[model samples]
Target: MMLIEETTVADDALPVEAFKAHLRLGSGFGQDTVQEPVLRSFLRAAMSAIEARTGKVLMQRSFSLSLTFWRDAEAQPLPVAPVTEVTRVALVARDGVQTDVAEATYWLERDSQHPKVRAARACLPQVPTAGAVLIAFDAGYSAAWDGLPSDLQQAVLMLAAHFYEYRDDTGLSAGCMPFGVSSMIERYKILRLGMGAGQ
Candidate 1:
């Protein structure tokens, strides 16, 4: 089973109230089985832990964790693939930036099919990227019209258009999906933030 945990901000960190409006935006997509309230509670606790450890709120971020399980029955080997579970979290900053985080864990069982094992292994690396992209897109678009340079703004628009085109031509509509645009947008926002801070 997939489990999600929420975190609370640290005493020295940004106020939780600051991010409340943006926090709920991405939760709809990351969690599948858990109730919204339960997920929120989990997130609150998780964020608190993170803030305590890191000394900053995980503003505009999303993450996921995955677990795999398998069981054996009988003297004779039963052929069954392991079950994989994934958990994802998205965080948005008060300023509208967002980040995605995800994790996957694998468990091996006796008498498991080789193909199933391989497929599960393959999906491991992809989980984090998928979560990150979703978070970045949301954060990027939400702040796209803000005080960005003309060139960078144009690039963002182009990326947006391309994402739509990709969705139309290929069954892969990155633009239409919540996570699709997030990764690129997140990067852009980071660059802008860094530049502004430097100046």
Candidate 2:
């Protein structure tokens, strides 16, 4: 299985000013925007780390997941949540033939932790022999940074600050995430399922 991000978070959607304030950096300076590029890179890095640890997208964006088979035939769980929509599902054969799955046959089962693409009836559409199933969807909290949950928003700021503070620390401490940041995101992390979860 492979998952690809289809869209990038827009620069304006990022909380650059908020992050600078969080870091207590001087404002109103002529070069205030000079450090923006570096700051944005750290923010992106922090967001990526947080998202990976939580299995939740903080910034709204599109994703495409491709799989050879389902872990469950009736309900295929999405990797991230909360999924806003399932844009498309299709089968692509090795010979390059494509078949779109009818939207009527499946529904998006919304869940905070385990959103899924569920068959409306008995089972989902079949994966063509020697072909792969492609699922395209949008996931995340919101398009704007302020739309994120308060805890999550604070967590991002805290983590980003940690990263900024340790920019020169190439030792083990540089790689360590603060306990508070971990605790803040712990509840958002997806719980592991049983052995049957594997395909």
Candidate 3:
């Protein structure tokens, strides 16, 4: 299965002012405006890192999951969490033709941790050969930054500040997340228990 991001978070949705405030940049000095581009980059990077570590989309956006066959026809689990809506389901043919699935055949199971697509009746439609099925859905906390959890907001601020402070540090390893951010986001991490592992 492949998950494709259709629409990304809007630039305006980012908390730029909040990030600047966290870095203690004063408005009167004009430094904030001078470093706006750097701040924006750091904010984006921090948001991405946090999302990757926690498996939670910080802002609302659209995504498409494509697959050759359903993992489970009755209830296919979506990869991302906090899915707000499933916009459409389509069947792509070998010749590149696409057909939309009927709305009556399926429904979204809205559990914040494990949103899924469940068959409305007994079973779902057969998966076509030589093509793919695409499920389009929206996932995230909310469209506004204020909708983010307080801890996540704090984590973003902390991480962004770290990035800003270490802007020229090439010694840092790839995907080098700070300890404070990790600890702050620990509770949001998804822990999957294997069979009988929960016992």
Candidates' lDDT values, in order? 0.30, 0.90, 0.86
Q: Per-prediction TM-score, please?
A: 0.18, 0.95, 0.93
| Candidate 1 residue runs with Cα over 4 Å from true position | 1-144, 171-199
lDDT of 3 by residue, 142-163 (tens): 8999999999999999999988
lDDT of 1 by residue, 1-199 (tens): 2322233223323222223332333445665334434334434444333233322223322222233222211111112111122233243344445544343332222221211222234332232322221211101111212333343333334433343235347665332323433443343331214543311
Runs in model 2 deviating more than 4 A are 193-199
TM-score of 2: 0.95
So what's the TM-score on candidate 1? 0.18
Candidate 3: residue pairs that collide? none
In candidate 2, what are the lDDT values of residues 1-199, reduced to their tens digit? Answer: 8999999999888899999999889977788999898899889988999999888999999999999998789999998998999999999998968789999999999888889999998999888888899999999999998899999999988988888888887785536778999999999988776873521
1 versus 2: better TM-score goes to: 2
Model 1 residue 96 CA deviation (Å) reads 27
Model 2 / residue 106 / CA error / Å: 0.3
* Best candidate, TM-score: 2
Candidate 1 lDDT for residue 144: 18
Residue 11's lDDT within candidate 2 is 86
